[model samples]
Target: MIDSHIHADTRPFEDFEAMAVSGIREAVTCAHDPLEMLSSDVVMAHFRRILKVDPHRAALNGLKLHTALGVHPRAIPHDYMKVLEELPELLSDPSVVAVGEIGLDSGSETEMNVFIEQLRIADETDRRVIVHTPRSGKEEITPLIADLLSQHIDERRAVIEHVNMDVIPLLIESDFMLGLTVQPEKLTPQEAVQILKEYGTDRFVLNSDMSSSPSDPLSVPRTVHRMRISGFGEGDIMRVSEKNIRKFLKIKN
Candidate 1:
């Protein structure tokens, strides 16, 4: 199973061999900012480790792990565009699966500009687009994103992460896949029902937005149970959880 958004290697370069042993197949790890990771503040304020996770851990394993270097919305700084200009080397990495955690948020103009730059990179590379929309105050930016996405046509596979506000329709109507997270509370059974009825059974998926916090990584399974409680059929759950997710990401890859 894939934790579509994770900080598995935040500081210690903590490999997922333990998570793999625990039964998860793989995860997509992302961090906030390069400066934050390399900053004195992480250790000074949060007492978090500031070590950079080596990408060689991905090479250490074959089927059990892969890494996606997320140029996250929160991470893009003043010189980030220049850094991004030099990212072709990183983008072409064998382990890099997608180009994201890189969309709009409740950030400053600087962050938004960086988001657009990353969007441009994804468009150029024609890879899977992972979106990270904030909980509120992001609707006004959709038109801008749509304009960028419109150029990619049928090849740009879109996946929006940690979606809590109602943007499923936009994703469904457009060419992207909407991934819902089941955390902070477990009673969003309504989300599954809403997606199935409103967006049909093809483009919706569930994800574990795990981080340093203790979370059930089997978030997709919990979502399936909730869907079952909400009157969805077993076939519907199977299709959304197992079949559709792989289908969408495979198309993206």
Candidate 2:
């Protein structure tokens, strides 16, 4: 089984290692460095040298936690133009499988600059992107990315993560995919069911988006289980769980 996005914070690497030790195949590790809110304080917090996150590490030790590198929206500061300028070398690291959790946040102007810059970085590095967008009235961000990714058709592909009703049209028009993270309690099974019904299953992928939320049910595997109850067939479920993620990440699972 696979969980699309995994973080080492709430569930640290040792725990990740143990899970991989048990039977899991693989997972992708991402860190939360939201650039949108990256005030001067947050700027100081990012590991400027993100490539060296863990040089002592190798996929061999456990379930092989691959990495997706990017300066998240909440971490973008006034001087972010400088950071974006340096992202190419950081993304070139061998451990980077994708460039993500990076995208627009309606939250601030700083975030917008970072998003556009990150889009540029995605283009220059010739890598796939994993988008993270907030739920707000402004759904245009998704399509903006589609247009951006479309420009680099031969070199880049993208997946917009954590979408809602506003994102459906964007999903249909573009070649990119939509992500549906599992949050059973927050949405009530009925609301989730209605959402699944409103947006039929094709091109819809699932991710845990697991961060501080550690309730066992909110984990990646559990997200799959909830989708199953919502009536998604095995083929549909596997496509979201494995195929879509694999295609976007450009890796074999």
Candidate 3:
């Protein structure tokens, strides 16, 4: 199985081993702000760690780690345009799969600009995107995000992450895939499984979104187990846990 979104840099090495044991063969660790005062240099270092360091760490624990690089809205620094200027080159790295963890947090004008810019870069570069939708104001902010996305890039090129029941209807009919994150603050395993049952697994993928905050590293595999016990078919389980994300990220393996 593959965790479509995660923050492996913030996790202990043992979590990777536990994830491996839980049947996660691969994961995509996205760039996020780890500091209170972020800078262009800090963002670059964070990107490098996910691109270079985390892969080695995951490999050592018997998992393959892929990465996504972007300026998360919550983490954007004053010199964020500098990071944007350097993004295209960093995204060229083979281990980098998408331009993501990017999107609106506070609905600020700056967040809107940065979100649109990254979407443009992803579109121009033909990379996939993982757009974030914050838990707060998701209902109000999601439609705005959908509007911006419709204007900037192809819907097939992105997944709107951290979607709940309310946000699902906004993108359910669109070409963009929906990411169901299983965390303490996000959907529980049962709720995620119920979503797959109600909506079908065709356009849905599962993720942990695990970071330094309260999260379950084994969320994906645990959810897979839930699906099995819930009598979901093998094909459906595969679609949500692995196949959909592989196709979304264009991952060969």
Candidate 4:
């Protein structure tokens, strides 16, 4: 199975191995700006390692990795445009799939600028975009992002992430793809199954969105299992967990 959105670079090696053992065949790993404690080079190298297909845990565990390069909205730096300027070169690499995890956090002007600029880059490069929306205030911010992206991005090339019940309708109104992150304190595996039950497969994609939290990296696989037991046949689970994402990214299994 493919976990469409995961911060695998930020996860421990053991987690990658464990995820592989649990049937994660591929993951779309995204890069974030360095925290105040770390240097930007360190963050860049993390994405580079995945792009290089480092003979590290990801490869050793039989997990194929693809990457997305962008400044995570919450991590935007003072010189955020520098990050934007460097994106074209990174997106030029075939290993990178999208310009992503880029969108509003607090809905600040700076965050919105970074988001719009990245949208332009994605449009110019004809690359897929993965947008991040806040867990709270999604109703207020989703429309703003939808408006900005409507002007600058190809709706079909973008996938909005971390979506929940309230924001689901908002995303559905747009032509863009939607992702459900099955992580702790976010959307649970059962909730995802229920959502698929109600929403049907369509353009929906499921992800672990696994990060530094105690979130389950095996959430995608677990959700698939629960979905199967819930009388959702293999085709239904496949459409949500794999097919939808493959169609969005134009990737082969």
What are the RMSD figures for all models against the true structure?
5.3, 4.2, 0.8, 1.9
TM-score of each: 0.72, 0.75, 0.98, 0.93
Name the 10 consecutive residues with the lowest summed lDDT in model 4. Answer: 33-42
Angstrom error of the Cα, residue 127, model 3: value is 0.7
Model 3 CA deviation exceeding 4 Å by range? none
Please give the lDDT score at residue 1 for candidate 2: 53
Cα lDDT tens digits for candidate 4, 189-252? 8898888888788878999988776678899999999998899988888888888888888777
What tens-digit string does per-residue lDDT give for candidate 3 at 1-253? Answer: 9999999889999999999998999999998767753678888888778888889999999999988999999989889999999999988999999998899988999999999999999998999999999889999999999999999999999899999999888789999999999999889999999998899999999999999889999999889999999999999999999999999898997
Sort the predicted structures by lDDT, highest score first: 3, 4, 2, 1
Kindly list the per-residue Cα lDDT of model 1 for residues 14-127, writing each as its tens digit: 335544544445556554453453333332222122112434453354213344544566565445555666555666766566766677665667666766666677667866
> If ranked by TM-score, best first, what sequence of candidates would result?
3, 4, 2, 1
Model 1 scores a C-alpha lDDT of: 0.56
C-alpha RMSD (angstroms) for model 1:
5.3
Reference-based lDDT, each prediction: 0.56, 0.61, 0.92, 0.81
The clash count of every prediction, one per candidate, is: 0, 12, 0, 0
Candidate 4's displacement at residue 124, Å, is 0.5
Question: How many Å off is the CA of 154 in candidate 1?
Answer: 5.4
Q: Cα RMSD for candidate 2?
A: 4.2
TM-score of structure candidate 3: 0.98
Candidate with maximal TM-score: 3
